[model samples]
Target: MGGTFDPIHNGHLVAASEVADEFSLDEVVFVPTGQPWQKDEVDVSPAEDRYLMTVIATASNPRFHVSRADIDRKGPTYTIDTLRDLREAYGPDTDLYFITGADALEKILSWKDADEIFALAHFVGVTRPGYELSAAHLPADTVSLVQVPAMAISSTDCRARVAQGKPVWYLVPDGVVQYIAKRSLYR
Candidate 1:
């Protein structure tokens, strides 16, 4: 699963879990973007912070792992690049599934190297709250639309909660809650 994963909330974990189970994937790697091209206008927390939080959130899950390929790439993150990197690392024999939110999947065609993306890996578009999932625009053989456990939780909301000095205990993991408090992120 690839995302900015600004704080690595429950929704992310749930989506990854669902996709892994549905696809019978050996492992689900969470790739946090180094510089989220789409959200460049807004302030994103440090890449290290986001990476560590992702690690913390997925630490206990044996099937879940965090990858720093995007964070360490040192450039604007594009989905194609991510897929390519993982493909190269895992080799040609392995099947790679690019898991993303339904909203992002809607814009897949607009992304650079759209054709190459589909050729590289299968895409899984997981539904999130308020996002209408439609595979009409995607290739039937390349994309799969799935409804994960409905989670209204968003990283943006979690950041806002911290900024407002509000509690975000259950919305995020225990370690994340503590990390946010210790680092005074979004304050």
Candidate 2:
């Protein structure tokens, strides 16, 4: 699963778990975008902070792992590059699944190397709160739309809450809350 993962909230964890269970996936690697090209309009937390938050959030899950490929790589992050790097690392035989929210999947055509995306991995679009999931427009063979338990929490909301001096306790992992406080992120 690839995302900015600004704070790596519970919604992300639920989606990844639901998909992993439904698809019988061996493992789910969380790839936090280094420099999200699309989100460049807004100020994003440092790459290292986002990466560490992701690691803290996924630390307890045996099947969950964090990859710094996007953070380690210089320049703006494109979805194609992340998928290609994962494919290269995992090799040809291993079936790769690129898990993302339904909203992100809707913009697939506008992405760089759109056609080549499917060649690298199977795209799994998980239901996200407030986003209507419709795969009717997408190629059925390439994209699989699955419904996961809905959680209203989002990294954007979490950040706002922290900025307002409100609690984000259960919305994110305990370690994430501590890490954010320690780093004075979103303040």
Candidate 3:
């Protein structure tokens, strides 16, 4: 699973958990992007902050882990590069699945090295609130559409809540809530 995860939330955890269960995945590694190219217009939180929040969010799950591959890489983060790095780390035979929100999956064709991305890993498009889960436009063989519990929560919303001095409890993990407060993020 790859996302900016500015303040890793419960929705993200739920989606990962559901996907892991449905696919019988041995582990789910949450990879936070270093500098999201597609979201350049937005003032994203520091990569270290996002990475740490992700770590706090997934720390309790034995099957969950965090990676710094994207953060460690220089320049704009792209899905293709992330997939390639994972492929190298896991070896040639290990089946790699790139889990992402359905909305993001819809824009897969526009991503850098789009075609090559499919070769690196199978794509899993999980359901997100307000986003339709459809594989009509994607390669049927390399993509799988899974309907996860609809999670209306979003990082944008969480950030807004924090900036507005509103509580973000339950929207994100407890550790993340504390981390955001401790770091004074999104203020």
TM-scores of the models, in the given order?
A: 0.98, 0.98, 0.97
User: What is the per-residue lDDT of model 3 for residues 1-187, given as tens digits with 9 covering 90 to 100?
Assistant: 9999988888889999998998899999999998888998989999999999999889889999999999999999899889889888888988999999988998999998998889888899888888876678899999998887878999999999999999999999898899999999999
The local lDDT score (0 to 100) that residue 98 gets in candidate 3 is: 91
Estimate the Cα RMSD of every predicted model relative to the unseen true structure: 0.8, 0.8, 0.9
After superposition, candidate 3 runs with Cα above 4 Å error: none
**Error of model 2, residue 160, in angstroms:** 0.6
| Candidate 3 lDDT | 0.91
Better of 2 and 3 by lDDT: 2
Backbone clashes for every candidate come to: 0, 0, 0
When sorted by lDDT, best at the front, the candidate numbers are: 2, 1, 3
Model 3 per-residue lDDT at 99: 94
**Per-residue lDDT for 1-187 in model 1, tens only?**
9988888899999999999999999999999998888888999999999999999999999989888889989789988888889988888899999999999999899898998899999999999989998788789999998899999999999999998989999999999999998988989
Residue-level lDDT for 187 in candidate 2: 93
Name the runs in model 1 displaced over 4 angstroms: none
Clashing pairs in 1: none
Measured with C-alpha atoms, the lDDT of residue 3 in candidate 2 is 91
**Highest lDDT model number:** 2
In terms of lDDT, the poorest run of 10 residues in model 2 is 128-137
lDDT of 2: 0.92
Instruction: State residue 127's C-alpha deviation in candidate 1, in Å.
Output: 0.5
The parts of candidate 2 lying over 4 Å away from their true place are: none
Give candidate 1's whole-model lDDT: 0.92
